[model samples]
Target: MPASIHAAASGSPTRADGRASFQKARRRASVQALLLALPLIVFLLSTFIAPIALLLARSVENKEVPASMPALSRALDAWDGRGVPDEYIFALLATGLRDAQQSGQLGTVARRLNFAQPEFRSLLMRTARSVRDETPPAWKPALIELDERWNAPETWRLLKRAAASPTPDYLLAAVDAQVTPQGNVAFVADNASIYRQAFLRTIAISASVTLLCLVLGYPVAWLLANLPATSSNRLMLFVIVPFWTSLLVRTTAWYVLLQPGGVINGVLMGLGLASHPLPLIFNRTGVLIGMTHVLLPYMILAIFSVMKGVSPVYVRAAQSLGAHPFTAFVRIYIPQTLPGVGAGCFLVFVLALGYYITPALLGGAGDEMISQLIALQTNTQLNWGLAGALSAYLVIFTAIFYFLFNRIVGIDRLRFG
Candidate 1:
């Protein structure tokens, strides 16, 4: 064989070496990226995604009671709430309550399970007391007679409800929905449908605020975009100065500023602009005003950042061609600022939807947002399932908003800087 042919056959390869080297480099780069991304991925999962996933899970977290008292749950599972629960059911409740009390977690369990019915505590307390006394099964009649409320249908219903794993009762009640009289599918009561109304009010308020911010912020952004650099910078500082103060302080300040006897009305009365003080604070007007003030900066910043990058030459060229200033602005400049408008509107709307302290403190009962009700359920009513479900719905809505925004307006076109 020739020397060259021998060398080729001996695997003095050229193409294979290049391919092998490229694959090795690609693999190393991929490994490096994965290593660099690991901490951030873990941090995001733990802090952001994990909590939200847990919250979503809590929407269905009805297993606490049933899991804690599995034997009781099984005993009550077949027993309907039509009449007094059987002796086995009572014994199960007694055992579970004793266990819960011993663990010092009865309060937490009671708070969660109470959402099914209000009279759970008395039943639990009575059962816990009697069961610890080593009373015979025949003493059940005496126990029933001790508190006849124990024999009530609703009381049994409450127990039977708690006995089930993954009850949807609290989640339904959050929206004012509940199981039918037959304990079948859930139904919403006409008068108790406050959640739907509150949901609509939230959407409407958010939309109105977004519109107000756009109308107010657009002109300001245009002015900033057109102004001398120093003047624009000074104005931007004033716009962003609100960020220096705490949100709570800003909201409280609005309450003070808009209250009937506060600065605005005081000045109005003093100037004889009005004979009587206007009802400004503690209403929808106050909510819109305070929210707009706080959110306007977001709108302005979003718009101004995008506007800063827009070329002024388009407008100038249009004007030079004898186009009117308004025409030039509308034709040449407005289209370019749309991405900012959409982005700012979306940001403001989502923020408004989740607003709590501002509306709670500054607005009246009529103007209360869904978040206030969620807080009420979680704190005052001690309805964790409902709170969790409400939060889940809010998260779902936010995701939908993001999806729609991404679909309708390319997020890539929306400027952040």
Candidate 2:
């Protein structure tokens, strides 16, 4: 081969080798980066992601009936919903109840059934006692004799619904709706419809608190941004100090301050602003005050951070061009601080949505939020499924608000420092 051809061929192989070497180096770097991130990935999956997955799973989980009454659940799956199940199913039910009662699983099954219909728990317990105490020749008649509800088609349908695993019943009930015996989706009775109103109250409170924070925090943030460094730093402490205090302590302080005979009401009555002590604590007014006070620091810091980066020249120039000071501030300065406003509002609103201790301490029964209901289900009722469902709805609402905020204000532009 000629020298030129040999040189060209050698150069091609050299370039190819360079390309391969580059690819190998890139792959090695990628592996190193992944190794560095592996711990964090594992931590997130174990702590955050896994727990959320479990919560979502628990929302639809209906294992109480199927696990405790396996035979009855399986037999009910085959039965049509026209009327009460056959005598064979009744026999399975009696056997299952006896086994469950003996195994100490009857309470779990009864509790799960009661969630579907309030009276089912007592009915099941009464029948289970009868089944355990006596051996009936025909379980259908014996169960019917024990409770007339056993003969009702609606009772059978409720049991069948509860028997199915991975059910929507909990989720439906979370929204104050339910699946009827006829397999139709319907709102619960007016008296039973609480979750929907709770959800609305939660959103309403969150929005109100966010608005209050913004209204109260904006001027303070502007002052902090405009003041000398020494003055601003001293003033910033006022905002930061409360933030450093424990949340429970802060809420408790507010609880004392806003009570009927506390400082606020005392001041008002002393000043002759009111004839008597006001109903400040344990109402919507107290909830808003407590939440706004707690969240104000966040709003002020977010806006101040953004304002620090914004030049004063813009507003000055606008004012020099014959605009009033307030007009210049609104038209020039306010728009520049919008990213911070968005960040602060979103943060405060989301935080307010999940507030438990503050509201529980300060607000009354009528002002109960969704978090209160979730706690009631989990702690008082021992209904993890309902709690999970409520949490799922809260998560969904947060996600929706996040997307809406992202779309309207652009999440990329949000500035929180």
Candidate 3:
């Protein structure tokens, strides 16, 4: 063979080995990069994803009684609600309470059962105290003598429920529904139906705030986008300055201002806008005012960011084409700002849903949002399951709202402004 052909044949295998080595080296680098990121991925999974999963699980999980009083819980599982559970079930409960009292699990089981029945905490506590030193009792009346709750079929139902796993009771209660005597769901008594009303109030307030923010912020954002740089810079400070104060302080400030005798009413009265102080505080009006004030900046910033990108020349061109000033602005300018409007509304609405301190400070019991109820269930009632249920409800609400809004407005249309 010619010298050139021989050289070419020899070079081919050499190039092939070089290419294979390069591919191996690239694979090794990718593996190293993934290994470097592994710790962060694990950390996020542990801290963020795991806790959220646990919270959602707690909303449905009902293992507290079973884990604490397994013998009693298991015995009650076979119960039919046609009558109060048999005395043997009560006998198992007595033994369990005595053991729980000794083992210090009595209060835990009591509180868990209380979420289902009104007086279970007292019932369990009283029984635990009486049963602490007693032997297993087959005497049903004696157990009933210790507590009248043992005589009620409803109490038995509550205990039977406590023995269950992954129940929908808390979820139903989130919407002001409850399991009936025959194991059917029904509305809670009208007097006690607070959650449905609270949810409606929350949705109404959030929507109102979102609308108000969009309306008020649009004008300010437009002015900011159109104004001289120095003027816009000065005006932007008004939006940014509130962040310097703590959210609690800002909310408290609004509380003081919106109260009947506060600065706002004082000003209105001095100007003779009203003959007397308006009932602005501790109601729906006060909640709207505080939430709008606090959340206005987010809307303004979102819209302003987008509006700044829109050239006024578009409106000018429309006017040059013989469109009236109002028509030009409406047809050309407003259409372009729709993305910003959607962004502002979505941001404000979702943020407003989770606001706790603002509404709690400014709103009455009737005006309270779902977040306040979640906090009440978590803190005062010590009902983690109910709290988790409320949290899950809000999460699901926000997610639905987001997806629906995105479908209508297009998430791709969302802009920083």
Could you give the candidate ranking by TM-score, starting with the highest?
A: 2, 3, 1
**Candidates 1 and 3, the one with greater TM-score:** 3
- What stretches of model 1 exceed 4 Å from their correct place? 1-16, 78-86, 98-106, 139-144, 147-154, 186-190, 316-324, 411-417
Clashing pairs in 2: none
Off by over 4 Å in 2: 1-27, 189-192, 411-417
Clashes (backbone N, CA, C under 3 Å), per candidate, total 0, 0, 4
> Each prediction's TM-score against the native?
0.85, 0.91, 0.87
Model 2 alpha-carbon miss at residue 252, Å: 0.7
State each model's CA lDDT, in order. 0.81, 0.89, 0.85
- Candidate number achieving the greatest lDDT relative to the actual structure: 2
* lDDT (10s digit) by residue, model 2, range 1-417: 976678687775555667999999999999999999999999999999998889778899999989988988998888877888888999999999999999999999998887777988888888888888899788888888878888999888888888998899889989888887667899967676799989999999999999999999999999999999999999999999996799999999999999888999899989899998889899999999999999999999988999999998988998899999999988778878888888888889899999999999999999999999988988899999999999999999999998887665664454311
TM-score for candidate 2, residues paired by index: 0.91
lDDT of 3 by residue, 254-370 (tens): 888887889999999999998899999888888888899999999999999989989988888988989999998887888788888888889999999999988899988788789
- Is 1 or 3 the stronger prediction by lDDT? 3
Best first by lDDT, ranked: 2, 3, 1
Candidate 1, poorest ten consecutive residues by summed lDDT: 408-417
